[model samples]
Each structure stands twice: as structure tokens, then as C-alpha cells.
Target: MSPDRSQTAYAASAADLAVRALDALRGIGGTAMVAEHVERAEDPKAALAAIRVVGADTFAPYLLADAVFHPQDAAAVTQSFALFPPPVSTPDPPPAGAAEPWLVAWRDWAMAALLARLAEAEPDGVRAPRPTGAPVLTDPDHSQVSDAPAGQGSDSHAAHGDGLPTPDSGAPDDSGPRDTDWQRWSVRMGQLSPLALPGLDGPVHSAARAAPLALARGATRAVLRRDFPTAARITRWLALLGAEGVALPLDPVPLLAHLRLHGGGPRLALDVAIARRLLGLETV
Candidate 1:
């Protein structure tokens, strides 16, 4: 297939898998009694590619709503990590909010860590394989960083004093938006929205903690510009903050409703659904 055709095909497959994952997220949130499984166990390569697109979100139902973790899904995720790995080398002492390369590796590490914890249940005698770049699990339910040092464990990005980077840490100014610039800041935040999930922590979360109002303002700006995707992603950050009990300047409930009305894709739907759960408004 030509590059264009290949890209198109991959996009279609990823979209379908994302919707299936969305269904599982909604179902586990009580929209349905049981969520649908998302792995294409028949075709490991296709499944792995789809999983790469979905990223850590493949486990949203299991992570967010306590849904059962099937071994097949875990195995697929493991395979993706090993086959389609994150960058092998990170910037030494990676800049906080480092660009795509580090973020990819960092997210993979967190996803792997979460996968390991979910495996502890071992339902039906199926234990998930540990991915190569995962962080060490220490109190999976809480504490974003493990006991390992900041630079330890696959550049999972605990580069500050503790596992969590301080809000005051140096910014990735050249690569990302500076906090003073809400417009560009929002775009960068949107890109890092995937990191906004519960049980995942790092520099981005610390930044959000310090600037809930900034995120809110950024979300509002995105909405004003009719950039629903960016708006929705920023809303996800706000929702995470709300979940963490950080006082948000703007109420996320109404913003979520707005995004639900305007957003037009399964990935956006998935973000909204997870945001609802975070805000204790899980009605699917």
C-alpha cells in the first residue's frame, strides 16, 4: 500500500479500537453491566498498532472504574511496548514537559506500571507480561513516583525532588508553552492531556496542580476559538484536577456538557466519559 493508503487504513483501525475502548469505559462506568473487550486477539499486529494509537487509554476501564483486566489485552499491550517501543534514549535529565519523545517513553512507563498492578488480581490464571520500560510499582493505588531515584526506571520522569515534579521546576520553554502564555500553554497542555489520567503522575500533573485557573482559562480560550478537540483535552486536565480535589476556578461540569455537545469523534467521547468519571458524574 502507498503511504497515504497505509495512513488511512491505520486511522480507520485506530478509530474503531478507540470507540470500542470508549464503550468499555462507558460500560464500566455503569452505562452497561459489562464492558466490551477491545483487543483483536486474532491479529496481534493489527491489535498492537491499534493499541499504540489508544496508548495507555486501552486500560481506562480497568484503571478508572475497576473493570476486570483480561489477560489478552495485557499481553497485547506488552507486545506493543516491546515491538513498537518508545525512544530508547531520553534527554539526560529530560526537561520537565519534554517534547514528544520523552513524553512517549514516560507514558509507556506509567502504562506499564499500571498494567503490573492490574495483573496482581490474576483473574482466570492469566498474569500480564511486564513491558520493558515500566516503572517499579510502589503503592499502585497512590503516590505517582516509585521509590527509585528521579532518573531511574526508563526515564519515567520523576526528575524533580520527589517523584512528582514541583510546579516551580524549570519549564520546557523551547519545546512547550510557557505558563504566562495561556494560548500556547493550552495547546501544550492538550498534547499532554493523556498524562492527566488518575494514578499517573509527572511534571504535567504538577503543572496542572499549580495552575488550575490557567487550564480553565485555556479551555475557555479553546472553546471560544471553536477548537473542540483542544478544548476537550484541556477539559480532561481540569477534570483530573477536580478529581484530585484541586479547586478549579471554573466548574468543569458545564464545560464537559459543552464539549459533549460540540465534539464529534470517538476519542473526544472517550475523553468526556473519563472526565465525567473523574468528576463523579459518571452517567455515560
Candidate 2:
């Protein structure tokens, strides 16, 4: 029978044999190449061998996908040197302790290919990192929030009484002030800037002030303990605050403890968030 039209009986038989050959091709690469050689060979047995090899080589990934929702192949294919996205290595770090290496050459051709694949993988855009799982305080008891009123009075009320009280009243009222009478004003707890609190001064001081409250309201209350995402959100917030020269309670001990409890990647990620925050980057 001719290879093209082995006609009636042989066509059906060959197709079945071909399928079996393909199935067996799942395990080895060189074997599949050899199998293709066999399939096209004058001998029918040769063709079957090639297809078998190819079939065997292909089953592992199929079986794996069936077992777990792993994106390993997709990640691998996308991360190929020639097909990765530009953003994948943005601000790529310098090799540890070595002189800075210029990436212009490495980025020349491969970058375009990589970006193409990345675009296909993420049609819209690369997703920003986000905390996975429940919001730490989504349905928080909020008893604390309710208790921690912004001002001594109500949100709308002035300290002593009436509408907007003089801003001076928001300051501390010293017994007998000399210069700067404004210093004599009695500032309400939440009315005045937390920074201006009596002893709240330097970076460490501000950190100390907020640290206790955050710890009390956060750690002790299982805020950072139960919710990693919330902890990350707080880390990002504090980082940005630091950039603005605003002090934050971000000692490594508490930060690491939060991360360890909540479970997230890289301690340095927190540092990046803080840097971004300080630089006026949007945390939202």
C-alpha cells in the first residue's frame, strides 16, 4: 500500500497504530525524533515507534496539571531568556557585591520577545503584588476603632462646645505661658497632630508612640497574627509614611514577627514598600 492512500483496511489500522505510537511518545525527546523517522520510513513498524516515543514524553505535564493547579510550565515558558517581559527584571539588582553591570546589551533583542510573551500571559498588565486571603480588619470588632475617637468630643463637635473651636485650644495649655501663647492652648488628643504630642519628637519617638497603639490594636488583637495581607498593607503604608519623612513604627523585630505570623515573601519586600511609600507612590 502506498503511504498516502494505504486505502480501506490499512488506513483505519494505521490510524489506530499511529495513535498508539503517539501515546508512547510521551517520555523522551530524542526518542520522539527517532519515532518520526520510523513513522515515515518504508516500514510501518518504524512509524509506530516514533509516535510512541513522542506520546510518552508528553504525559508528565498533563498528569501534573490534573493533580494540582500548578502554573509551572506557563511560568517556565514565559520566563525563557528570549521571551520574558521587560518588567520581570525591572530595577534588576546588581550581582551581589560586584561592580554594576549594564543590562543594555542583554535587553536589546530578548527583551522584545520576552515582553511579547508576557503581554500574552497578562493581556492587561502585570499584576501588582497584593495580600492574599481575608482582610485583617474587614469585619473587625471595631470596638477599638469606635473607642479610639478622633477627638475628645464627637467627630463633628468642637472641644468645649459649639462648631469649630479656635485651633489654639487644640494645643496644650501651659499654666502661665510667656512667648508663643499658642503653646498654652489645650490640644485635644485626636485634634492635634499625633506628631505634636507632648513627648513625640524624633523618628524613634514617633515610632514608639504609634508602636504601642499598633501593637495593642494589631498584634495583641490578632490583627497581624491572623491576617498576612493586612500586615502587608500596614507595612506598605508605614513604608510610604517613612518616605514622606513621617515616622512610623517599623522596628525589624515587630515587622519580622508580623511577616512570620502572617506568612509572606521576602523581608526586603517590606523595605521596598516603605521606600515607595516615602517617595509618594500610591499605596492603594
Please tell me which predicted candidate would have the highest TM-score against the true structure: 1
Q: Which stretches of candidate 2 lie over 4 Å from their true place?
A: 1-225, 249-253, 257-262, 265-284
User: What is candidate 1's lDDT per residue for 32-76, written digit by digit as tens?
Assistant: 211222333344455566677776676678767756776656665
Error of 1 at 235 (Å): 0.9
TM-score of each: 0.72, 0.20
Q: In model 1, state the lDDT of residue 63.
A: 68
RMSD of 2: 24.5
Query: What lDDT does the true structure give each of the candidates?
Result: 0.59, 0.29
Q: Tens digit of lDDT per residue, candidate 2, span 48-109?
A: 32222222112221221122212432332223322323333333222221111112212222
How displaced is residue 74 in candidate 1, in Å?
1.0
- What lDDT score is found at residue 134 in candidate 1? 20
Given candidate 2, what's the lDDT at residue 23? Answer: 33
Query: What lDDT score goes with residue 167 in model 2?
Result: 30
